[model samples]
Target: MVLLGCLVEAMHANYHGSYSSIQNRSSSIRVAHCMTGTPRTLYKEEVYTAYRHQVLDVLPGDLFVVLEHINKTEMIHGTRVRADNAIRYKSALKYLSPRIVEWISIGDSLGSIETRSGYAKWKRCFDHIQRTERINGMKYDFIVRTRPDLYFAKALPKPSKLPKDKILINPYYECVNDIPSGYDRKWAKNLDLCDLTNYGVSDLFAIVPRALAYPYMCVAYITDLPLAICGERAHQAECAIKATLHKANVTYEFWPFVVKIKHVS
Candidate 1:
């Protein structure tokens, strides 16, 4: 039997919440929190406040952090955050002190907006896992991909061991005409129009063994743009991931958990 190991990839913004809850439950799990995009103006201070409170208090097995800087000229929701300000905002991460941290430069030049974004998201998570394995010289049994902006109501249950070809994904809240309702209406409607039969995997979280994660996360690189771009941004993301997983020939099962999205304040 494969030994139980986990690598938690928390990508996106950091809001207030104790990951310690998870550590308390499983001391062996390694965490890689990846923060991306320009910080939202509405909750800039709040984001830092939460990061300092929750992320800084790392547990014993928390591996490292990947801080990817967004381009200053990039407009996210009509806001262009200055590079200097981003640097300043990231400076505070010093409190993570003894923990290993890496800063990566990111820009719009990576590829077409949708494809590049999807690629970057998956690449960061995959890269970190590879890095940890290299440094520790050990392979992980499972990899958990998640977002920092989310707050889990309780400890996530330990993933059950599965055949190397199988993965564990959370079921989407709903599917409107086969389109995931978790996406915005425009994207959802567009996806529904496309009528993709096997397109309901929630991108929010996934737990898979290292054997399958390599192919699953590398989907962005191999995705067919013409097919994935049929829907809006979120829809494009869904299609890319789903398409890639299908090509990789991986089967999935859902692991239930209660998680809530923390709004920007």
Candidate 2:
């Protein structure tokens, strides 16, 4: 949902500890972070340090990252990215120790705005997160699907304070909290209060429950089918997410947390 300006790169990971020993079994709410996307100026301390203070300080969990395989440079939407920006993402590893890191060669497939292709890529990310979770023998109460570039405007709500059955997403349309104002206006068109009545769901971020994680993240699987949400409309990113949830009969609510795509580079 975010049109990023910075070049995307894989994290230069430095694993210092095993997650098995780090996670506290007695923690009331266990969260899993699935990070996909290039955050602007990731190497800066101001970015990751804020994440540590605002997000991890409230909800600590294992981090899963899927980055595009980029070389020295990449040009997207006529924007040229140099080698200096490539190395910036590496600095993020020092702050957030990731659990599983994977890379893929996206080439030029994502040069334009195509909903199906976008969701298909997300499908792979979801697969990686779920696959590693099973192999690691870890189960989380909620899975947070977000981007490394997201600027958390508010601390994540404690698990006890959120609804257990609904998908949590950034406020959109006419939902509660009036949908914060700092985010990109393009993403604003999709929130629609995370409902199907108007726009669709906000694709920028989603807090999926373990029960509906597959249906929520694996939306590429159901993008073609006639959805009950809009009934045979054009394939859209928000529509695809909302339709899949409708099929699963799962509802979504605004998380009340504000996040904007951080553009530092």
Candidate 3:
């Protein structure tokens, strides 16, 4: 196990080149973006034209993934596998495993169902990542949660540049996707973290350490984010995710990476 981990880590470091920053990371890391929300008809083409160049090519790992199963696709592995909706996924199958999920109707409000499903995607993706670790008897040093649709003008920061104990999030906007949600560290200071937590973390992307992966990925496991955040009944993402994080006492830092959710079509 130790030998396997060292080999992957060495390879990962080589990808970034030999530098002092290389010492900041101890093991191999996997970065991923989830393909979720409403799928566009031309999504596959966009992946090659935009996402691949702007996001994937810039990042260091091949297993880069988020959640959401597109088409009949499955998830995270130690090898290079692309999980997408109606897209072709892969060059290696030796470490790839498809996650079969059975869907059940929530009958909740449409927003609620969407919210739960989104978080479930994160949870399930991480589970698959962890499963891969077990199968190979090795663990990733870090895990990144992102969506494939975010248009990035610059490369997301590598895990070596980030702190392991803090869940790294983007600076929040007052209204993302026309919703009144976004997180601010200043506003959260010294207050009941959960009370102010309804002001959600920008879900654009997050960098998580292995220690905090469970709390970071289990947002779907919570029964009601709106109620938990501010006593409402239905609010889908950001603020809801904030409530879950604050409740878990998870610490976070806003990394200065700039990106926006762009329409694929």
Maximum-lDDT candidate: 2
lDDT of 2 by residue, 1-265 (tens): 2232212222433223333443565567778777765445556676677777777777777777666544567676899866553356767866777776555454433333334435544555565555555656866778888776777766776666556787878755345436454222223324444444555677777778877676776665553443456544434556767666777688786555677777745
lDDT by candidate, in order shown: 0.47, 0.61, 0.47
Report the alpha-carbon TM-score of model 1 versus the true structure: 0.57
What's the TM-score of each model vs. the native? 0.57, 0.72, 0.58
Candidate number that wins on lDDT, 2 or 3? 2
Question: Candidate 1: minimum summed lDDT over ten consecutive residues — where?
Answer: 181-190
User: Which regions in candidate 2 have their CA more than 4 angstroms from the true location?
Assistant: 1-22, 70-86, 108-117, 173-196, 227-233
Model 1: per-residue lDDT, tens digit, 84-175?
A: 64455554444433133444455532322345444455555465556556666565655555544454443444333333566756555453
Least accurate 10 contiguous residues by lDDT in model 3: 10-19
lDDT of 3: 0.47
- Candidate 3 lDDT, tens digit per residue, 148-264? 556655565544566777887766544222211222222323232233334556677777776777666666555444345534523646665677676667888665555667673
How well does candidate 3 match the true structure in TM-score terms?
0.58
RMSD of each: 9.6, 8.2, 11.8
Rank ordering of all candidates by TM-score, starting from the highest: 2, 3, 1
Error of 1 at 102 (Å): 3.6
